[model samples]
Target: MLDIAKLARQMPEIGQQMQKDAQASVKRLEMAQQLFFQANEHQDNLIKAQELWCDRLIFSPGTPVESLDTAIDIPEAPPSHSVFSSDGSQIAPSHHEIIYCYLINIGRIMLHYGQNLHPLLDSIPEIYYKTEDLYGSRKWGIRTEEWMGYQRTLKEIQILTEMACTWVNPPGAHFNVPNLAMTDGSLAFWFLDTLPTEAREEILNPVIESWEQLRESKIPIVGYISASRSTEAISFLRLMACPYDVPNCNNYCSLDNEKNPCQKVEPLRDSSLWQKILQPRQRSAIFRSNSRILDFYPESQKTHFCYLHGGAEVARIEFPQWIAEDSELLNQALSITLTQIDKGFGYPVALAEAHNLAVVKGGDRTQFFSLIEDQMLRYGVRNVGVSYKEARKRGSIA
Candidate 1:
């Protein structure tokens, strides 16, 4: 009567279907966004109030911005005054309107790492390296040629800085709100060995040299933000990149992007929240009357599990009993926490291995504790620990 094998055989297919469904959902959202914005011809204050940092150019596919000598698209735009069309329709440029380069499309977010000679130093350092075991997990290292990744990141920084230099900071620059270099990666440091020595000096010399001047003069600020997998990393880097040292403070856009796809973040504690508050945006998708689409719970959401492995470079804290709790309030909290850990769940956060709270027993509590501890260490987690004795006293079983 046992059908274990039969059930096992169907899981892969089931997983594949779920993946397709998730992807489909993403596509649908993208489409809806386009339709909503375009329906009003970029008006209506729904989507195009302000240019999105990386929303798929909802208005038009990017075209080569013609010559910089003639690059100021809105010459009519006053330096600080809001320029209006002859028809009086508002046509505000993106806040990031660097005169020389416009962000054509936002590429995927990438993590940057660094080394204090520790892969997952139990204690976080003040800086990260692009190759220093991203997120303190071996699995997270870029698979491409280390040199190539180095070159690519370097190039990205250079291009961005150049954009700032010519377009954002150029003489007669339009609006000035401090030049913020929002990157998920490390801002100041890079892996030199991965790059040819000549390329290293050539590419980084400008950034280093120019940044030093900015650091000294205190007129324009360059900030480094590292909100990668580690909150400690963020704190640590923020300290290292002191406002004077690197004043900009990795303040990326706050108005709810995919990293924080949910707009109505309860408690709204993430660093990004402060960013949204500080740099308020209206007539843009980042802020609106209805709030971000993230607040509305959608049906057909998929749940994923991360098999908790102990002592891993990145470890998550979860219990084998949350799902089993009988308390109404406790159960709700448990479900929310567990769903947050789902690899497929919205937003990125620390993760742990999956434990079927439904099936685990009080007897297996010791093993569970051991598992959690080991997984945590392996993943560079030093925050929480599993207490088998506590579990046992509470009659916890495997």
Candidate 2:
């Protein structure tokens, strides 16, 4: 159905554009690298850069905070400990299918490392199919896809929190050991950025409640980013180079390069900068995030992150500010995280297994739809069928 001839004609132009972009990128990269090395070597300058970021960096209306610029060495992991991870996969609402429903499957894994590898617990998939969950009505007050996606994110946080609580206070056994609870990505609820104030609050309130439950459980939970391109560190450099102290400085700073001391590192990612400095199993200083989303988070749940090297590429590991304030818990979190990364060869083993458990195969969906059709027939609604577009996709072989 595609126009191959037209595509072929455009290929040469596309290739030329890509080449030009690549060359420009290389030039900027070299400049960023030079600035990174220069800043890393000069402790006095690094300190100054941090101060400027704290004092003048343009943060969201209500989010103005200081930075924690102390880089602690990676502590050794204990010989025996437990690590738990959770991941979720979703089946989005389909317009082509006879059934208009979505499903979210969360897979959780708890692994204990002592004399040998031991699996402690694994959870069965949780399914929801109530009247409120299946339909998109004016009464629901939100679009079907938006509501379903938001539910999936909320479920992930809730599941992680529930698992952490269960581990801390089991019905049969009691153990007083330090363990780490982790999810696959950043803890910040990114969905809020796309919603209106009231709609955002509806989702955010419950998510924050779940976070509070996890915090009260006193278990260290981390959001692991294997390969990060965040510019939080570079933002510090920009603040150091900022020309004016006024709230709105973009108009003046862009042209006043002479006054901007941090201009050389204007556009650099934190991971790229750390890749040059951190050794295997090393972690950079923990820094508080000035992300606008933090303004909505409860005071106890504000997020902070650190750059780490776990025998692979540099990554960003994020946690709540509460964890960072506690020395013992922070060390435990850093140590266990490094252990998981080493075991999985740069990725966390628990998260990998969780993903594997949560994945929904194509065959599974086909079988599931077939079962739904059978149920419909039993209910005397046999005439319901997939859309014509879906039927055409399954054309006869002969």
Candidate 3:
């Protein structure tokens, strides 16, 4: 427990420092806003700079697909539409546990508006304990926890894709309404960038296949990030502010020197920029992600994103290149997202419900381990025990 008296003694100093930081932040925001307009005015030059320095830049700058300064008003919501979302939670394999195993629980939700269709909510739990499942391929060298995270994301998208497919072609009948499929985070396979070609293919192949299925079904899918601190847009603005004609950061810019022209609008995020630019329910222009992992993705699956002012905060919404290029589909997706946020009170209802279902609480973890131990005992293997470190954590100590 914290000592209130000790904390109170330091509160004055902390408060003073916080005030100073707040003032500095305000100054940065003003300069950032100015730089933002300047970047917009010189948008063509900035785009040219990106083209020239594409291979040399250290940061991932977004490539604008539309006018850089434009903010489109939210499109009218459809009278009847469906939104499907899936989220997942995992109990990563732990060495301190009685058994080396993990559990993945996926929560899926489907909500139809103006159609009188009953909403669907379900959760699926799966366990991985086999040697092949736990360790994965020896060549990959990825930790079990990290591998499980990737697998969980894949399962979420796969399940969401399956849900959309079923809705699109349900039992000899075709239901045609504006449908949107959403996941909780980025769709990019960025984590696979460090892995070998074989490992990347092993992971990305299925994800791309799922994306293709959604595309074939003509269902628009998106990855929604709430209160995002991503700086891809800010990085683009920084590039626009670069003094070098060629803008070669490796040769020209130095982090040790605080005099870099691009550092003028330092310590700002994409969301902070959008919060100043976008009105409620409006969305910024779409920008293509420059993540290196996209080199492995097909043209159709390349990731694109835009910032949306969804009432409470700026949100980063990402989708595939195909969806971004299709104006009608993009508008439908934006409409669904804004409407859902309004209904859910600043968050999407489908995603909120899915998260509620996916979360594994403290009690759930305890019960999970107890069940494993119970099964081991049932098999007459009574030697099952947690690691000493885990046992100490559970017991009281003076």
Pairs that clash in candidate 2: none
C-alpha lDDT (0 to 100) for residue 66 of candidate 1 = 20
> Which candidate, 1 or 3, has the higher TM-score?
3
lDDT of 2 by residue, 233-267 (tens): 76655543444553234444444354354455534
Q: What is the clash count for each candidate, in the order shown?
A: 40, 0, 0
Global lDDT of each candidate: 0.28, 0.73, 0.89
Off by over 4 Å in 3: 255-259
Candidate order, lDDT descending: 3, 2, 1
Model 3 TM-score relative to the real fold: 0.95
Error of 2 at 382 (Å): 2.1
What overall lDDT, based on C-alpha atoms, would model 1 receive against the true structure?
0.28
Task: Name the candidate that leads on TM-score.
Answer: 3
lDDT of 3 by residue, 295-394 (tens): 9999999999999999898999999999999999999999999998999999999999999999899999889989989999999997799889888988
Off by over 4 Å in 1: 1-144, 171-179, 188-190, 193-203, 210-227, 231-398
Clashes (candidate 3): 0
RMSD versus native structure for model 1 = 26.2
